[model samples]
Target: MAKNELHIALVGNPNSGKTSLFNALTGLNQKVGNFPGVTVDKKTGSIRLEENFDAELIDLPGTYSLYPRRADEWVAYKVLMGADADIKPDMVLLVADASNLKRNLLFCSQIIDLKIPVVMALTMTDIAAKKDIQIDINGLEAELGIPVVTVNPRKNKGLTELKKVLAQASRMNQNLHARDFMNTKKLAPESVEGVQKLFPQLSEYAAIHYLINHENFPLSDLDQKAVEQVETVNKFNPNKTQAEEILQRYTRIRQIMQQHVVEHGPLEKKMFTEKLDNILLHRTWGYVILLAVLFLLFQSIFWLAQFPMDGIEWLFTKAGGWLSTTLPQAWWSDLIVNGLVAGLSGILVFVPQIMILFGLITVLEDTGYMARISFLSDKLMRKAGLNGKSVMPMISGFACAVPAIMSARNIENKKERLLTILVTPLMSCSARLPVYTILISLVIDDKYYFGFLSVQGLVMMALYFLGTFMALIVSYVMKFFIKIKEKSFFILELPIYRAPRWKNVGITMVEKAKIFVFDAGKVIIMISLLLWFLSSHGPGNRIEKVEQKYALLAQQHPAQADSLQKPLSAEKLQNSYAGILGKAIEPVIEPLGYDWKIGIALITSFAAREVFVGTMATLYSVEETDDNSSLRQKMDAATHEDGSKVYTLPAALSLMVFYVLAMQCMSTLAVVKRETRSWKWPVFQFIYMTGLAYAMSWLTYVIFS
Candidate 1:
């Protein structure tokens, strides 16, 4: 038999620091896309050692076994078998967390028995050491006939040794080159990169659909040759199953590991984790700690963002003034200043707020505290019969629901993942904060309750609590329909706490915030500009007549009009196109405690709920709000056309209830649609949420009136 070049695939469990190792080896040169039609993210990068010679590393999705359990696992297994690719791997780099070595080696043994050259990156060695579990790499290598390399990728340890070993392995591949292309042809160097780019992907859940493509997997030896190999040595083992090829792999790994590796010390963490988890996981105490953490998270979002947000606001406010002055005050200028500039600036202003949140979440995750949160929440989640893994996404829903839903792939159970995705939106995402703030400001008094919770603040907190309560109620109801035959295992590995990696945290915060600001900012900017231009220029005599009346009034009582302002122009009568629009919509919105100006704010705010404050400011014709002058003060002083109080208690209460229940933000809907891979769910979500808001607000109005 002619020898051929060997190809080794790198595989591991999720969060096993596999990507960290990949990144360290091939810094900044990583390419990411999807694994075919499935939304499972694929990232691949290669390392070049000294000369033109190189080792092509295929970083496969983290999976529990070689068994095709989930859509992601199927792709990973398909790629390794080369069954679908017309090429097969010659070897494998079985990276596993040393702390969780027992479960990790299950995949390694499967690869080894397949007759592939095996090398293992014993990642998180430091974590294992902290837990007082020492692995003898030489002993492991000798036992398995493969090298065992210990690595602390996060700390950049063992990188030099890893490079030396990879270079050596590449030469070994040269000897494996064959005479014919069929068996094991020498892989074309150029095509190696091309093949790496072509990630093994199948069409959607066709990989998982039982009623549809259950036989969709690429041909396997076990399917055709299992009966022929049933000799005395290969007697049928009860643990093995044909359902997904994972059980045999698991059985073999456990058998091999039983020969080596010893268990030591208690399973408890001795450091900050112990102290933290003790309070954090307590039945009652844990929830209180969670609330405390949330308080800091939300409070910081408002308080810490003040300086940066204000600075950005001022810069944008100045830019708008410059635009109005720099360009001709014609239709083009109106579009630029009102539609484009105004929209763009309003969105850019929120950058600081998104950054602050991104930073806090980065620190929380890199420190590995999020995993423990899942452990702490298992009981509570299971009360609704949700998977323990659902807790992370639910907590992440506090940050944003789109990603929380996208992340449900890590959840094994199909029903649990779907329910998590469905209910995650009920967790008050950052998008809802804008609506909550506006409604609270309009209705709830800012007066403190016994020196602490301001009624306005209390209203904001209630909105958050209501959203969380809403998720639980939905999950509780969904629990009856979902069938979970396999009990979820909360086998989360709490990595040893290290000092916060500020460099990594800073980069992550910047990346996340950049993505948020760039995407949502573009949408909001266009919306703001369009809304501005629409408000600035109108088509009819009604608008022209108001402008003529205002112009005449201004000429006669220019001083009266100058001193007539309460630091906000939008609240004034017909001076703003937005104000005029608000007035026009007032007859319909009056019962909701919203004047024409509030009506205008609500209309524009649909682009993003947070745009309410900015829209109100623009409509009010103010550059900024100060302590001596705020949007609430401007709104409170405004009068209806009949000279009645524009913002009465009933109207304010109705608006608050409306904002709390309504689906006003478009970005959230876009993300939900994308995550569900269907518009049906998001459409249903929007209709139900809006219906709920309308009904609740109507009830509040009737009762209060």
Candidate 2:
């Protein structure tokens, strides 16, 4: 709002490296927020525009024209029109890719029509140079009557020149020179339907937008004055309308580009990108590579994340032990040490694993490899009645289902986006990681199988594949009833690879870790406390009775009591609050080979999958164990009345199968509601996934029993 820090807005098309440039200039001085009434995230920062001048830089969303097609598109168009808010920019900084000048220039032309004080930031000169595509920057600037500065935004090469040009534009505070700046002069009377006929120049882009009735365009706050003037012209000019006139403006800009821009790109395609895309975008091999990459990604998270996960788990268990013993022995001690401290530590322990996985994903996304995954998966998805744009959202489901479901905005087709939203949660998310990790450890051992693979790794891999396969099958069934034409063409830009930006990757990992720790932590901690209360205190004074009975027996036959302490300890647990709950849930979970304790775990874990590890650790640590025995060994020796071990291989397999299929994450469900803009889809998704998990677990138990 203050010109003391002169506002300079950066505008560009998608993949124009506008964000990278912003990062190069401002670093961490940047702050991200939303434009007033717009969901599009806005990034602004302070950059030295030129010597002795500090400029406030605003980076607008990537868009093709002032004719806004989507929410992201509208934000860019509105910021320039000065309709967004009171913070009108002093200078408009337009960044366009020099390699794609003709396509990029059309957008600049639209901005010119808006009559803003403009300066152009030319980008991607490196790629242009590599391909031997030459352009005279001064020549183009003189022809367009604007100052142009060549920049390699990633390398921070163009900041000095760009800064100088901004200072010059600031100095040229001359009267508005744009002839088109005088707002619309009103069109001749024409019928609403005949308006299109009056504006022949706009026929190309408008006809396409009109046919789809693109809903992404935010028209809620449209200018009434512009609307009335357009309506008057449309009434008489039956042959043309306001929309057409706008399209004609773009056409005139296209003609200008055709005359000045050379057609070298088509003739000599960037051999490097062309050659790489040929294999990466290949019909058959492309899909294989995509699948291979995803499999590797999932596998890497499982294997690489395990060390930190194990170390963190050990730390929490030891800390809980220390707290419980160090405190004075009383109800306050148990609640504070076991309930409060353990509960908080439980959720924070998994931050390490989440950080590791998120770190890997950030690298994949920024390197342009993730887009390729969407490109390869789009074809098979459409056959199953979804769009290629749906692939990114679906893959994101693996991280957390809620945001993945929300990312469906990129999908052009309403039905396809909805269908994608409906089934994405069925794909395994990282929340399921804790469940799969523990169960696989129980059934398959940590060691490699047949000398080449970790047995536990193989099991983890299977669970991920299982979730993915089920998602495709369900989507196929949904397609039979939800009719779609599958007519939209995907415009995917395969960006050239750049070295991984560690700072960007680190920032992403830290942000994601904090979000998951706090967002999911609250639910988990509450569940842990409630569960702690439930297991600690039971009805009819059963726990007091156990203490009384044990003390009396211990005095009468001290040696006998010593030998039977564990079984008596089991009775204490059975009589406690957690024990009764376990019994209550035991009947329902009985068919799955789970005891009342395991039943308690199954119920609490729905808050989050990783909570299972903490819950189990808390329960096991309550009973005393020999100093030499590890938690796993103590668990392996746990027995029923029949002297059979509770955690048999078959039972572990059943639990694994259950967690692999269950829709257990509550935060994921909440996210789904926000993303879909209704409860119908998330409710359906939750029910289907839970039912699927139950049936699969039941079948596994029945077969083993």
lDDT of each: 0.64, 0.69
By TM-score, how accurate is candidate 2? 0.79
Best by TM-score: 2
For 1-705, candidate 1 gives per-residue lDDT tens digits of 222233457788877877667767766545555566566666655566545555556667888765666767877877665554533555577788887887887666655544455677888777676677777677677656666788777788887887667557656752321221111102122222222233224211111121122245444555323222322233423222233334444555566566666547576557566776677778888788876886787678778987887798788778878878888858788787667776676566666766677677767767766676677777788788676789767766766654566667777666677678777777876656765665566656679878886888777777777777777777888678666565555566665555555655665556556556665565566666666655665556655566566677778887877654433234333445555666688787665556667777777666766667676665555546554247667667667778887667777777767766677766667766666678987787788777767777878888988
TM-score of each: 0.78, 0.79
Give one digit per residue, the lDDT tens place, for model 2 in 1-705: 323458888888887777777777777767765566644467788887655678888888888766665667767765675545645787788888887777777677666655577888899887777766677776677567778888875677978887887887888873224344112323232322232343343233232232222233333434333334445554434235446655665565566556555446557655776777789888888888888887787678667877886787677778778887787889878887767777777666567656766687678767777678877777789787787888877777786665466557667565777788778877787777757765666556569667898777777778878887877788888878766555566777777765667776776677567666665667667766776677678888788888898889889988797666665666776787766777788878877887777876776676677666655655565343324235566667777768888888778888888787777777677656655557876688788878887788888877877
The C-alpha local distance difference test score for the whole of candidate 1 amounts to 0.64
> What's model 1's TM-score?
0.78
RMSD of each: 7.9, 5.7
